[model samples]
Target: MSCLKQTVNVNKAELMKNYIKKIFAMLGILLFKVQGQIEDRTLPTFATYPKRLKINLPRNIANPQHIYIGDNVKFGPGCFLLALTEYPTSKMRNSEFNKATQKFNPVIKIGDNVTATAYVQISALERITIEDDVMFASNVFVGDHQHGYQSAATPYKYQPIWKINPITIKKGCWIGQNVIVMPGVTIGECSIIGANSLVNKDIPPKCIAVGSPATVIKKWDDQSQIWIKS
Candidate 1:
């Protein structure tokens, strides 16, 4: 009788342990789903669409369709893409004062496999192009125009003179977090821009640039397959 009672107690404990383990496993799965695990949620279905170019997730808005997205472009949540045509009503007048191009609005051409994180803003009064396999980190701003300083005193309601230009980010470029690409700048192919850098000039291909006014700190070598200090 004593032996039977001990056996029964052990069996019950084992069953309870199994139940707790199952419950924990279920909670773990639920947490992953809520955290945007693509395999567990709606993301995979959305990603499956072959024509789904330039996907802007929640918190993102586009006023103008200046975006010409080719295949495999993924825009993370909170990314904003706008054209001069879609400039905020309050800001449009300011932009026109320094207008650089006769072009009514600029164009943004995003090529294949471009990935951008949250709070990325790409604006153009002239063309801004991102070529294949470009990756942009959080809070990156790419603009091809600036309000003309000469028109600072102009009424906010009046058109401000704009100095529009072009920005081209070529293939395989990885822009680090919080980097700002200013007007008329070209980030050459296979280059990297370090965090918090302000790019005001052309960056040569296969180099790494960092600084307030970006300066190349390293150049990539094809033979060595490494980035060496320049």
Candidate 2:
């Protein structure tokens, strides 16, 4: 009788252990569902979001009203896009005077089918227009303004001027990794900018540019149907 009782107790303990494990498993599933819901809520729905737009988490968008993104745009993690409606006077020397005089209503218009990888930073103080089918690799910086220095005595950070000319990236351009497109520069259509290049001037269409202050290395020849060295 004692042996039977011991066997019954062992069976009950095993059943309870399994019941406890089942409870813990259910709790884990519930936690996962709640986490998914929280992540879904964090994605911002813009007023002008186009069809099939997929943006990963941790995207920083400043002045969302001034920024416009077109259809089928995909942004990877750590993308920082800033379209300043007003100039950042705190960074300038004549803060109060510049704030009163300057009218900085910047616009960042990203055209359709654009893909930007991780850590792409676009600072538009005046205007940064990215045309259709542009691809930006990781750590690409496109800014329309730079810190200015009016006098030799003054520091560069003290004078910040928004460039009058905008930064325009024409259609079907592929900007490589760690490329910096500076103010008043225009990247022409179907151009491929090599990795780690700094674009300080205008790049013409259908060419391959490389290096710091990128120079045209090759150009597409329509007559020969090949890329000729520039």
**Best candidate, lDDT-wise?**
2
Best by TM-score: 2
lDDT of 2 at 218: 99
lDDT of 1 by residue, 1-230 (tens): 99999999999999999999999999999975665554223332221233545444454434345557767777777877766663334435344455333335657788888998778989776789999999999999998887545555665334443667889999999999999999889899999999999999999999999999999999998999888999
Task: List candidate 1 stretches off by more than 4 Å.
Answer: 1-56, 86-103, 155-161
For model 2, how does the per-residue alpha-carbon lDDT over 1-230 read when each residue is reduced to its tens digit? Answer: 99999999999999999999999999999997876566456756554767777666677887778888899988887899887665444454374344343457888999999999889999987889999999999999999987666667655555456455699999999999999999999999999999999999999999999999899999999999999999
> TM-scores, in order shown?
0.71, 0.76
Clashing pairs in 1: 96-160, 97-160, 97-161, 97-162, 98-160, 98-161, 98-162, 98-163, 99-162
| RMSD over all Cα atoms, model 1 | 6.2
| Model 2: CA > 4 A from native | 1-40, 43-47, 89-102, 151-155
